[model samples]
Target: MSTVHIKPVPVTPAEVIAVARESARVAIDPEAREAMARSRAFIDDIEREGRPVYGVSTGFGALANTFVAPERRAELQHALIRSHAAGVGDPMPKEVVRAMMLLRLRSLALGRSGVRPEVADALAALLNADVTPWVPRHGSLGASGDLAPLAHCAMVLLGEGWVLADDGSRSEAAPVLDAAGLSPITLSSKEGLALINGTDGMLGMLLLAVADLRHLLVMADVCAALSNEAMLGSDRPFQPELHEIRPQPGQALSAANIHLMLQDSEVMDSHRNDLAHAVQDAYSMRCAPQVAGAARDVLAYAETTAARELLSVVDNPVVLADGRVESTGNFHGAPLGYAADFLAIAAADVGSISERRVDRLLDVTRNRGLPAFLSPDPGVNSGLMIAQYTAAGVVAENRRLAAPASVDSVPTSGMQEDHVSMGWAAGCKLRTVLDNLGTLLAVELLSSVQGLQLRQPLIPSPAARAAIAAVAPIAGKPGPDQFLAPVIEQVRHLVQGPALRAEIEAAVGPLR
Candidate 1:
């Protein structure tokens, strides 16, 4: 993987995804190092003058009014990190941890966190070495900038916490650093506060969610097209002129994609002039573009918010270019919280509609001439009966997870940090919703491909054919059901992976 050079400018979502999911190495730009050094001087001046700054010379949160003696200030920094590292739950995924590390490094490199150049360099070194700290899944209220989760990451910088090896076993940070030819750094003044005081954890997850949702949204369109063909639904609703009149960008894009995918389809062409077909199909078939397109628009809105946040310096007591160390509320995670929650709601609806399409494809009466559950021997073999149940189960779970986490906040730090954002919780739930959405789409693909196979003499469009061919090995022809769970999982992998998209795009050009 190529190195993702960190500069003072905002980092892109792609860079975050590359570093997080692809294990890309990171390096600090020279200009960013210079900026960090310049900012460090301001903190040093405040320290020398004995001025009482929020995190520089005084305590934090509820203890902000407390003063620390000069001699014990270093101990105060260490104590802050140790006490705040109170996260509890299963360890976060390695990708999330890595993304958090990269995002923190980006914030530091922006030269606003009042840390020494070496502090930023240490974070970059950790990323380059692929040494991820073991951050917990819980303990962040999303206000005060993901305190506990970031504190766990900061502990690794001090060589005081646990780090995960390549194989995922944990070891002491000191030994890991030693093996990696790195040493722990002593914290001075605001360095510890700077390290842990940011919304990096929530932002990292949001960016990752954005990247994944982008792909899944396109796949949503693809699956809708496949399901439409399988159920012999009309393509008239997806006409360019029909969507052009509405002019919702996402809706137009979705309509265009479905319209193009159904071009030259024998199944669709077979019924193009049939007078007996229903004047309008069910909402799941006729309004796929509206539902999936609205989800696309929501994802775009989240992306816009994420882009603005990528340029943000989300820390308390940020150092200013005018030589003042000021305390600010930039660390509040409300924006990220709202974005994650909104995306979750949209994703859940998309999954819900996809499951509806799966049901339509499985029903004997509704699936036109297809078998019940698409089984060759309907009663003897339970073709995909349980698969619809699985999709329905996941859709219900997605709906439950879609309840906005941002609206529920609990005060902490003795009410000093009240009205927390809970953005991290929102991001966590969005991840699950997206994962479930992928599974729901996979189930639809499984049933739709079987439906299309049963429509044998009348071929699906080239793009649908390409999609069916891609999953044919794993999801074989419409026959007696074999072990179904493994096949659904394998198809889910294909849905989430790039190969299926590549094949479809190859046949019908790119989807929105």
Candidate 2:
């Protein structure tokens, strides 16, 4: 139970995820009131002239050039939502919907989309009230601004689409809106275009991925410390001077984090002998800083793109302060779409490296003196062998998903949308990578903890010891193959958390 208050001020995607995850309420910033006033004034001016405006007086897409009868303008808005609600495949998770809603509200909060104030208010209310729309996961090229999926969202605004109501049950959007005493929004001028155009889907994916990446960064340090202890590898490679010469922010951060996690440990110091194992550690161990550092770098790039998107006004026929209507490419999603694919690739690497470590920890040959599969009985039980296999399978799946969706495009509306970012696919796959990465790291954490237990007499680094202690409540050493699933499930719970990492650091003092 938490509350994130957004005071109409612009917020980062990370902040938006925090608010959505916590079920927080949002209010318009008083500062933005001025912008809203100016935008509405421009809209009013356009209405008074009543001449011609794209999406206002005419049709959409293939019919953009056609003149729409004034009497059917409102009908056009509703029809646009219905016709575009072409999403298919599995419904998105409720959390994703919550995230989408938060981002949509944030985008509208910028007050540059020229949306009716009530529409934004309705979105915020849905978020605060926990009324999430049931959005399908597919059917968006991420061009034409996430049209299909967003239409599902907009449909709810018009008292249509499927929704999760107050009772936590699915219901028709119209009945739910009726129950909530809210009326559907009537399309005013370019309002229909404003509702569906933009990169919110991609924004949601990056927001979720960034949050996951932050946790993985901390877990990476913990995993490295554990692997270092388990394999008796030297911590000298993580020295500050080594990273200082290169002066990469992520490298320094990784070195510092690993240093902190391994500080003051008997196991770490014992392994400084530089025992000749292939003259150097495996790439997974030797190159932890490089690999994890690259991920951090990519995440930074994704964050920049996401921030710009959240603050952008992405819609057609953008209203100008002087009442000039301009149809522009503000709705282009290529930037975010590419960022999404790139970030997913980076995140997939996190899982790949983690799975490699898991494999090393399991194999008796490469695992130094640890028992085969970390099992007390080598022949009778094949402990943790299959865990590594599962990890490998997930890693391979993530690699497949990491292929950039932004590189592919298909034409639509007679080539009006010939080039698309496929942004929704990018966001969707990135989210999948986030889930896979979480599970991958969880397995590694579980294996590392079990391996550490095998070295009972010799203690790990102070920070590593603290992390083990925190997760110990959730996971215990496997007695046999009996219900290893329960132990694996705990990996998901403890490793992907800042609180657990903080607790470990508190006990260990500062990581290097």
Residue-level lDDT tens digits of model 1 in 1-512: 58899998878888998999888888888999999999999988888899999988899999999989889888998999999999888788899998998998999899988888898888888888888898888999998988999999889999999997667677899999999998898998898999899899999999989988888988888899999998889999999999888978899988888888989899998988999988999999899999989988998899999999998989889889998888888889999999999999999999999999999898988988888999999899989999999999999999999999999989988999888999999999999999999999999988888889889888789988998898899978988779998999999999999999989889989887
Model 2 score (lDDT) = 0.76
Cα RMSD of predicted structure 1:
1.0
- Candidate closest to the true structure, highest TM-score: 1
Q: What is the lDDT of residue 341 in candidate 1?
A: 99
How would you encode candidate 2's per-residue C-alpha lDDT over 180-219 as one tens digit per residue? 6766666665566667877776677777777778777767
Q: Each candidate's lDDT (Cα)?
A: 0.90, 0.76
lDDT of 1 at 161: 91
Which candidate ranks first by lDDT, i.e. highest? 1
- Candidate 1 residues lying further than 4 Å off, grouped into runs, are 166-168
The deviation in Å at residue 32 for candidate 2 is: 3.9
What TM-score against the true fold does each predicted structure earn?
A: 0.99, 0.93
TM-score of 2: 0.93
Range of the 10 consecutive residues with the lowest summed lDDT in candidate 2:
1-10
> Could you tell me the TM-score of candidate 1?
0.99
